[model samples]
Target: MSVEHIQNSVKDVIAYLNENPQDALSNDPPITAVMEDGLRCRATDEDGNTIVTDMPQAIGGGGSAPSPGWLSRAALATCDATRIALHAAQSGVTLDTLEVTTDSVSDDRGLLGLDKSVRAGPLSLRTRVTIGAAGVDQKILREIVDFAVAHSPVADGCRRETPSKVEVRIA
Candidate 1:
């Protein structure tokens, strides 16, 4: 079947389903980690710490040193890279490999208790895309990368910082 044909059919089917909903959609659970009146915000899990911030790099923290906000940005970058690759594949781009890196800088003094000149984070995510395909050229390759960036959900979510509200419900 043609790509356009499949796309059109998929949308139509989705529209019909929405008109006759079968099940309700819900968000996945979100757990917040907190440190009690501490300078560094910390949370522990069964295995240990927040799994990124600072647990103990040797045992899975930060190796005795962890950069602030690195874990959250790492998660975003990883998700972005995978989503980009998936979109590229769907768009007929045979991606040989993908490497994404994110560097975030904030007011360290203020946010991390350095001096009060630090802020949260304005993460700069840089992705180096390399593609190897028999028939794809430079122009097409550029388009592929653009498409990947455009379609990545994680990239969009991070770039937009889509506002969301968390409601705690107690029953």
Candidate 2:
């Protein structure tokens, strides 16, 4: 889609939100996953889009698909890249190239229950966004990058510490 089209769509959403504020507060459709075999699972969205996930053979799975941690990093990078594109489009900046790279460090000992001091998830994650846009002011591009980072949902989610509770049932 064109930049103008994306900008117009965003404007339309803003207008709708202004007119119907309550409609802006809606939940995302649920995503469900079921185990298939040997640590492999299929996750499906409400719209029926599916993704298969599995651990590496080193971790006792078939090495058929990317592990959840790798997926998380990929999700962060893609989400940031998309946000940057949308915000740049809204600002009338034409990007020739956009790339996002992410690095993360996690302690497997914690996941394996061998170390109580280390966390099970990533201890640190960093992302770098590179853009190539000629004729646009560098300051403006920097501001856009900052705005995208601030507005990205995945970035916000990774930065914040949210509580999670699990309920297990035996059938």
Best by lDDT: 2
**Model 1 agreement with the true structure over 24-64: per-residue lDDT tens digits:** 35464544566433224455565554632444454334444
Candidate number of the best TM-score: 2
CA lDDT, every model vs. true structure: 0.59, 0.90
Question: What are the models' TM-scores?
Answer: 0.58, 0.95
lDDT accuracy of residue 160 in candidate 2: 97
Compared with the true structure, what per-residue lDDT tens digits does model 2 show for residues 114-157? 98998898999999989879998889899999999999999999
TM-score of 1: 0.58
- Error in Å for residue 18 of model 1: 8.3
Model 2 spans with C-alpha error above 4 angstroms: none
